[model samples]
Target: MEVLGRDRGSVMSVAASGISATSFASINAAGKVTLWDVRLQHKDCMSVTTDINMLSGAEATDLLLAADMHVAVALAGGAIIAYDLRQQGVLSVYNHTCDNEAFLAGTHPPAEQTTLIADENGAIMPFDLKQCRPTAHLSDRFFGTSTTISATSFGALSNICCGLGFIRPEGEKPLLCAMGMDGSGALYTDPQLTPSGFSLLQESDLVEASGKVLNPPLPISASFLEGYVAIGRANGMYSIAVPVANSTLFEVLAAPGHACNGLSVLEWTRGDRPRLLTCSVCGVVSLWDVMPLVLETPEGDEVIDEDLPSLDVAESVRDAVGQQVSVNCGAVIGDNLLVVGDAMGFITSCLLV
Candidate 1:
């Protein structure tokens, strides 16, 4: 795979194809779009200039891995836009502003084209990227009364948030979890109910313990899996797994993960096995073995470093592409490339070879 960075600009968001595994795209602080042809050898593909001026003072917040040639980007101003690479860097698609567009997830089956956006306002807006209009909006009274929305995802089904608004991956139906600013979180399923499936609301939905003031980090971001959810706080990381029954298993501190600026989940190993990766504002990256951890309890949980090689460890490490700074946002590109963007507008591609 090829890693490219403009002379001075840092990338805002990066996304790649989970199917082809050889294509990727990124948007920079300058609002330029760079589409890479990973199938080719050495510095492949050209950079396309997107005249799409970012809303003034807005920064790129999050990115969604959607249809091939199409990438969804969330702006700091709470707006979301889908960029079509086939149109040569044209951000022809746009959506309305809401609470921070922390996460976006698309639908499956008949409505695979539908996408969901979760914001800080505790509102989950479902937008038909194909039709360009919102179809539905769901909000939990408990969440409205308690937490402020943070990160969100559809993979966990609908939108998932930590400390509130944690979206989970797809299943028989959509599931959503909200993390309260106070350190408690609640999980809900089938959000589109008449009275809102209050019975299905997972009891003791509260996650991570919080005091008057949380240490490390608050629930700034979260990542979702089929039955598991990973949350990034100022202090560390936590994972929660919900079973068919009321078997809610969780990790209070899944390793001393960093104060996350942003995070993403990658389904690799031929899509059979998955890994949990967390990126911090300090530019440190950690990859956890979800397989081994599941096979045993925390007391028996194997040390992550002993199980796998640490990518950020070593002397041969290449200095980050642009500057010596923290990576505020990160997304997995295919299975091998990691694209990191920092506050200073510096974006770099790290090879996971």
Candidate 2:
């Protein structure tokens, strides 16, 4: 859990509240989840906080917020719980007893109403918010195991050294992404749709991208936007790629010596371009101008063909930053506000600039 303070109260994960600019949620190493309102509060992040304990009684590994303000908490024992922030009560409790390792869960920005949870061993469980539980129609190996579906180079990879996300481009259906430490990632797409979201998995195709760059081969984080997915590395660099199933292409965004533990993307407006917000192991927050790396034309509709030849590319980087503190994970409240927490159990907030 990256317990720098060797305690359960140490922050393990943080999630942004898309509904509010100054509000967010997080879970500590001790499995305690808290709602945060830092609008005009202290920089320490403790300016205003409310602890929400669901009685899972274990360390929570990761968390994310839904548009309805439902906070999804992924715990260590394979059980994931969701809470309704509006009522400050439990929404449902789900148990995945297959893998004992800490699980990771996330929300796709394009489809924030939906969430996906994956175990270190590589089983993905999609949460059907309508049913208030993992989908019952899908088989256990429906998506195939991440380690074997389309994988190679086992010796150099750690199954838990992973990241998962999904992207919904302007005119395309949403696509789910699962990544492992070997630098190989797979994409699963289902054209059919449902009210609860992509529930029918009649048959899915696995697109494997061999394009990889793992500096230290350690655990990493993922954040997605439009058609691109950024993979944060252990040695302080991130790889931006098309995320198509082919051999794939890569654009490395470097932050020398600054181990990246977290990443978030915010799309641009008419006056400015898109940006990638990154938080590091040492609690430093930085911004990378991302418009140039994207394949989209200025019109923002047409994109480069995903069937492009495999190649590694580098682009000129324009970056910005803010004050530093000891950080474990964080969430972007709105366009510019940032809220983060560390293993010492201290919550903090800062501006991207």
Candidate 3:
């Protein structure tokens, strides 16, 4: 595997453009967003700094690249800013009147136009990209009356809320996955629900591999791959089947001594079977060949679960950067390029064989 490294100064988040796999966008702790052409030796194409005051410790927390050549940045001070990459300036800035900090921002399936912004209070706001304003507040849809309680109570419910992904079933409307801390999660499937209102299809509680209730599993990252959602927690990882009547736990992969902070599905090697890449807070990166539990249907019969396969721990690389620097996030760009971002603001590109 070919490896390349570049230090961009304390990167908070990194995202590759969907239109161009070699193009990447990253936001730093100083509120500076830089666009890079990784194919050209990680050249900086453009840079833009947000207007958030550094004195207030407000920085760009999360970023999302829209298909319209616009990047949406979620700020730590409860604001969302849409920046036009072509113009190299801010398209619009939106404040949701929320006192909590923003955690992550993403788009739902189907249209993939409206930007969903999740905050620390487990509130999600659907912002219209065309109008550059929030269409509705959706805290009640995900967390119910948990938002109306005290900060301590809300904090006990979950640490933060982040948009996982959109699940599209065969004959139903698309549902949005909102994963929170302490294994608190919800799936919203009602089409009539809007920024003005919201509804949910299911709510799930946290459970261990032994089916015991737990307080703080701390789901840090999640990704949807091969009809399943893999949630990386502080303790381990859980794979859940999508579009079910309730949240069905498929399998639990233990992490032992690592706190899973980043996860990405690598579509390499296997034709239809994809590999899972997980990064830990302890500066360890491991690849796993996950054989998901299969289901089968006989002639004119109901579907039943087949034999479950074990998770194989494949190749691993420890401290890809140096000692003790945590790998924050990573993505598999192009065909075989594995790009990882670290706490020290370095991006390492590895060409997997």
Candidate 4:
């Protein structure tokens, strides 16, 4: 994808979603956010003239996709700002500690009018999106490192070293799964978020491994399923059906050496199975054989389920775009389409077919 921005700085974050049959929003690194109509076939996307200088000497590190594609930018100076794309309004610019020591690491709860932001201080601050003010903040006893969604369910993962995946059922309060990031990949069931006993994603009646723990294998990305959770780990990609029954939760479909630094998972099969697209640091791109994931207990993890049928590889789409660059962030646009942002400041879009 070709990105046009007024700021000379590289794009820190980008989000694109089908707003309608004709319009989409593309926010760039310079913080110059714009909406485009591919149907009009215009050379440049429609620009929303703003008096507020978003990219003017502003340093934003990340962007979140919120309701109506509301763009929230995490500033380098440990503050957060949410902007509405459709309407020309500044939703809120969060005011917190101004100390240069603390940085805004990440933000979550993208859909809610209120969202949570992870700070360098290892705290998750819940902010009201409408007011752009902080309501409450909580600490997870660890640094706010990385977060992701489960393709099947609305659940999400907050992986702090050995971490917790938060799941809230309809009309029910959120539940926390005490998972470890030990190099070994699996979902563990610990009723409590504190350090305690937990169960791993295994098949035996004695599924919980006592001394064995989860070690951070590689960079991990997550997606949800109807009742299960799929994780894209660094060594390979695995899926775990939560609420462990007699079945194996973690299935290592792809093995080690498959760099999953930049992995993107989405609601695939028209909401049936979860689709997985991964771009590695080495510049290799691969697709997983995940169809609406269906796993049975005791049968062990199978590669070809009714949902996940096969693995596909489209070797380094980044390489095809001329010279290869180190990729850090990427997002899925509709189906069979991907846009990647690299350290070199290149935003390349590709048809995944």
Clashes per model (N, Cα, C within 3 A)? 24, 3, 1, 22
Supply candidate 2's per-residue lDDT for 244: 32
> What is the lDDT for 143 in model 4?
21
Candidate 4 achieves a global lDDT of: 0.43
lDDT of 3 by residue, 1-353 (tens): 22344555666666656666576676776667777777675466678875556323466666666634465454556566677777777777766555444333222222345545665666655556656676543343332221232221122124466445555555544556666654566665432333111222123345557777654445666666534455666654434344455343333333332335434222222236566555565545555555433233222232233433343443333445554566665666654456666667776665554
Error of 4 at 262 (Å): 6.2
Q: Record all residue pairs in model 3 with backbone atoms less than 3 Å apart, i.e. clashing.
A: 136-195
Top candidate when judged by lDDT against the true structure = 3
Model 3 misses residue 334 by how many Å?
A: 3.3
lDDT of 4 by residue, 1-353 (tens): 34322222354454545333233343444454455444454513543333234423345555554535454433444456666656655556655663111112212333345444444332334445567666543233222322332211121233332222443334433333334333222232221233223333334322336754433343344444334454545444444434434122444243332554534322222223345566665456666655434433343455443344356656664556555566555555555555555555555554555
Segments of candidate 3 deviating more than 4 angstroms:
1-8, 54-57, 70-72, 99-112, 136-159, 170-172, 191-216, 236-238, 241-243, 246-271, 292-319
Comparing candidate 1 with candidate 4, which one achieves the higher lDDT? Answer: 1
- The TM-score values for the models, in the order shown, are 0.66, 0.64, 0.70, 0.60
The C-alpha stretches of model 4 lying farther than 4 A from their native spots are 1-8, 16-30, 34-59, 67-77, 84-91, 97-112, 136-216, 235-270, 291-309, 313-315
Off by over 4 Å in 2: 1-8, 40-57, 67-72, 84-91, 100-113, 136-158, 169-173, 191-219, 244-272, 293-326
| Candidate 3 global TM-score | 0.70
Instruction: Score residue 137 of candidate 2 by CA lDDT.
Output: 41
